[model samples]
Target chain A: MIKVQEEDFDVGQEIKNLTQENHAIGGVASFLGLVRDIASNEEISAMTLEHYPGMTEKMLAEIEAEANRRWELDASLIIHRYGRMEPGEQIVLVITCSKHRKAAFESCEFLMDYLKTKAPFWKLEETSEGGKWVDARDSDDTAASRWIET
Target chain B: MKILYFAWLRTTIGKSTEEITPPETVKTVSDLLDWMPSLGENYSSALEKRDLLRIAINQEYADPEHVIKPDDEVALFPPVTGG
Candidate 1:
């Protein structure tokens, strides 16, 4: 399942829905990203996330498909929210369920790494000074690069 | 062709979308990037980091050398920062 929305989601409910139908799943791995209070020495008051409407969903679906292609998984879910959010608010969630722990773990991580680089979303930090667009971090690119098939 | 800008590119360029027909010389995305700044003063600074800007042709990530058509939707923005 893949969902892009403006409202916050219930992580517990989502995980339950993902694993309830699959009796073959032995393990589920999930990751949740939250908005930070501090960024680049400035105290962030809020964050505004923007995305290409049609493209965002398409890119996320492709990321999910790639994860399933690489791992033996029964199910996977990705929920990403865009719009104004405050510190500690959930931003994204990735969940993977498989017959074993390894596939679930690895694929969850892979989905996150790909989403960081390939997803068509941008974040703007609203700080004490004013709002500024967040630059793409080199670390994110490096993390995503490791997943590339050689 | 339809050109779209996002995030800082949209704010800096002062518009979200526009329609224009490029000359025959602008065959690829890189050529379009080079041609954009010449169209207006705002584009010069908005597109300062021409090499760093990411392109999406018809809603998928595309390279500078990607071929473009008059009906395609071309978007230009900075490197993605989402997770």
Candidate 2:
């Protein structure tokens, strides 16, 4: 299942829900994208993120489906937040459950990689020297493309 | 005719969303970008470089040559930097 929300979730509870009663599942691999308040000399004070209402969720669901098709995943979850968020906030969470560690690990990373590039989300950061707009990084696209080979 | 902008685009466009109807000749998304500079200086500034901007039509990443219409919902943004 896929869930996209602005509220913070209990990571432990979510993991338990994914792994409970499934004896065939050997391990659960998860990745949490924590927003770091990197007080770089870049002068960024606050950050605001925006997403396409119907599109964002759909794209993430597609990514999850792809991972499931490639690996023997029992369950997968992706949750993302929108609106104004401070540094150190949890921006994204992805979990993958499979019978083997390799599939779980690879699928978790694959989901994050796809979300970083394909998912529709925008970020606006406020800095001391005035706010500057951040463009999407080309490197992210390259990162996601690597997964298509597998 | 729904147009969506995000990130620096929101600042550069000075507005997040707008509705517009273009001429019959403007068939592709590239045509829309080429026409945006004429709308105002702010649009020209934001669209300074077409190479850096990404385009999506109807919520899917589209080619520059993709057909566009006044009824289509087009979105513009920079590449994904979020992790």
Candidate 3:
């Protein structure tokens, strides 16, 4: 499952729901991303996330499908929030469930790496000086690229 | 075709969406980017480094050589910076 919204999400509730009623699931691995108070040398007061509505969800679903194909997984979930958010807020969540720990761990990391690049979302950081659009880092590209089949 | 811009591209272009019909010569995404500068100064400035821009044809990431059709939804933006 995938969700893009403007509201905050509960990490505990989300995990419980994902693992419930599935006796086949032996382990669940999750990753949660949070907004930081600083960027480079600037002090970030807030950030706003923007996304292509129809396109964001569609791409996310495709990414989930790809993870499933590559791993032995029972279920997976991705939730990303958009719009203005202050520092220390939750920004994204990824959970992968499988019968064992290895698949869950690997797939969770893979999902995050792909999400960082493939998702059609942008973030603008607001600082005391002014607001600026964040640039996509080469490190992020390299992280995602490593997952590519060679 | 329906062309859309997002984030800084939308702000720089001063609009989010537009409808345009390109001539037969504008057959690919790169061709459309080159032709866009002819529209006005905003197009030229916003599209200063065409190679830095990322495009999507019908909401999927597309390459410069991707074909364009009159009924497609073409979107342009900077490289994604999401997590």
- After superposition, the stretches of candidate 2 with alpha carbons farther than 4 Å from their true spots are A39-44
Q: What Cα-based lDDT does every candidate model obtain?
A: 0.93, 0.83, 0.94
Stretches off by above 4 angstroms in model 3 are none
**Which candidate would rank higher by DockQ, 1 or 2?**
1
- lDDT by residue (A1-150, candidate 2, tens digit) is 777777877889999988897878898999998766554447556777778777887888889999999898988899888777777788888999988899999999999999998888877777777665566666777888888774
TM-score of each: 0.98, 0.92, 0.98
Q: Over 4 Å off in model 1, which ranges?
A: none
lDDT tens digits, residue span A1-150, model 3: 999999999999998898887889999999999999989978999999999999999999999999999999998999999999999999999999999999999999999999989899999999988889999899998988989988
**Fnat for the candidates in order:** 0.80, 0.66, 0.82
Answer with 2 or 3, whichever has the higher TM-score: 3
lDDT of 3: 0.94
DockQ list for all candidates? 0.88, 0.67, 0.88
Of the candidates numbered 2 and 3, which has the greater lDDT value?
3
Give, for candidate 1 chain B, the lowest lDDT window spanning 10 residues: B45-54
